[model samples]
Target: MVRYAQTDETRPADCVIVLGAGTWEGEVSPVFAERLRHALDLYRSGLAPKIILTGGLDPRNTVTDAEAARRWVEAEGIPAQDVFMEEKSRYTHENFLYAGEIMAKEGWDDALVVSDPLHMKRAMLCARDFGVTAYSSPTPTSMYRSTGAKAKFLVRETGCMIVYGVWRLFGVRS
Candidate 1:
């Protein structure tokens, strides 16, 4: 008999918020596409009944991350009514703050945060600061074993953790 680790009790939220990632010349990058794919999987797996695509238009680019994600998900057959877009945020902090407001207005208390695995820790902290009980659903990486990629992720995660710690200590709300 195989015994699996017990998973956390994750109740379905009114929405799942897919945080933005970089796009290459208006197209979704592989990392960004992975996040969207995870969000879709969450929906299909009954983790969340709805999804919120969060990001803003890059001044240099014509399309917003939210729009790109929405288009991709819709192409995958998710209904329009099941997707919400928060397209005014240009940073991770703004993504949580703006989306948190939307969730509150919609009477949602819980959310599944979909993002790169390396980002989920800080993202969850930011979401919690906004009064949302956020749970992370990291997008699985195909290159987790790459030494260079792992090093990059570690550096980024460490920097984010430091920033988040300072933000929380200073009573900063973002």
Candidate 2:
């Protein structure tokens, strides 16, 4: 668990999967921006030839997170063809669920999953549930840096982890 919780940012996979964070008024939040920054670094390093961005339209925003991410990455000079967008997931569980389908359709089997540090474990587990092989690649420069915030995220992750375990135990796939 300890190792899984750590970010293996250098792992070379078929693609870099950037999980969505909240967007404010159609703009990527700082949290999501940091995630994209890490993924950009991963791409620039030649770790992967492609990136997959995921998220549906959040309640407070007019545009989908995936679309916003696509724009951002394109602005960064990553060609549109190298970046795939899945804009139908509204939660972490659906992120992997929808991404798995996209992966299968696109023939992407293994990926470096990018998200906040505390989210890697459960996200990886969810990735498995959806039939996708993924590695943890949490953002090293996440704004969730304060000790209290980290602790809170850890606790929340614990609950989410247990819930996902139960869901999997019961044969719930989504």
Candidate 3:
């Protein structure tokens, strides 16, 4: 099992999974950029051999968060071939489950998950449930900004965790 740490180690993994963030008007939000930046940093530092961008198009929204992440990563010069997309998940649970399936198919055992700091714990939980040894690489706070915004995100993440826990307890698909 991979141990969580306050700072990233830059140790290579089988893969690095970039969790999706909000997008606005076909553009990635600052938060989204922050998450992608962390994933890119991890990739460049040799923390992972491949990057998996995860998210799906919101039925009411035009662009999928995964697609936007891919575009930004490509613009940053990461080769298209090195970036993988999981575009069927709309939530964290689905993100881990779907990405885990892909990891299993590829025989990946270790992964570093990049996401907002507030969501790291739950994301790690989901990853562990999927049988992957996972660690967190939080997006920098400078990129997230605004205490109000971070607070809101933390609240939402906690709610998601609670809901997911109850669902699992009742044998419901999260």
Best by TM-score: 2
- Candidate 2 clashing pairs? none
List the lowest-lDDT window of 10 residues for candidate 1: 1-10
- Give the runs in model 2 whose Cα sits over 4 Å from its true position: 1-3, 7-9
Highest lDDT, which number?
2
**Poorest lDDT segment (10 consecutive residues) of candidate 2:** 1-10
Off by over 4 Å in 1: 1-10, 142-145
TM-score each candidate: 0.87, 0.92, 0.88
Q: How much lDDT does each candidate structure score? A: 0.79, 0.86, 0.79
**Tens digit of lDDT per residue, candidate 2, span 22-136?**
7888788999999999999999899888999999997778999999988888888999889999899987889988888878888877998999877887888788778788888
Q: Candidate 1 residues 26-120, lDDT tens each?
A: 78778788888878888998989989999999998889998888888889999999999999998787898899888878888889888766677
| Candidate 3 TM-score, C-alpha based | 0.88
* RMSD list, candidates in order: 4.2, 1.7, 3.0
RMSD of 2: 1.7
Cand. 3 Cα-lDDT: 0.79
Quote model 1's TM-score. Answer: 0.87
Residue 50 accuracy (lDDT) in model 2 = 90
Q: Over the full model, what C-alpha lDDT does candidate 2 score relative to the true structure? A: 0.86
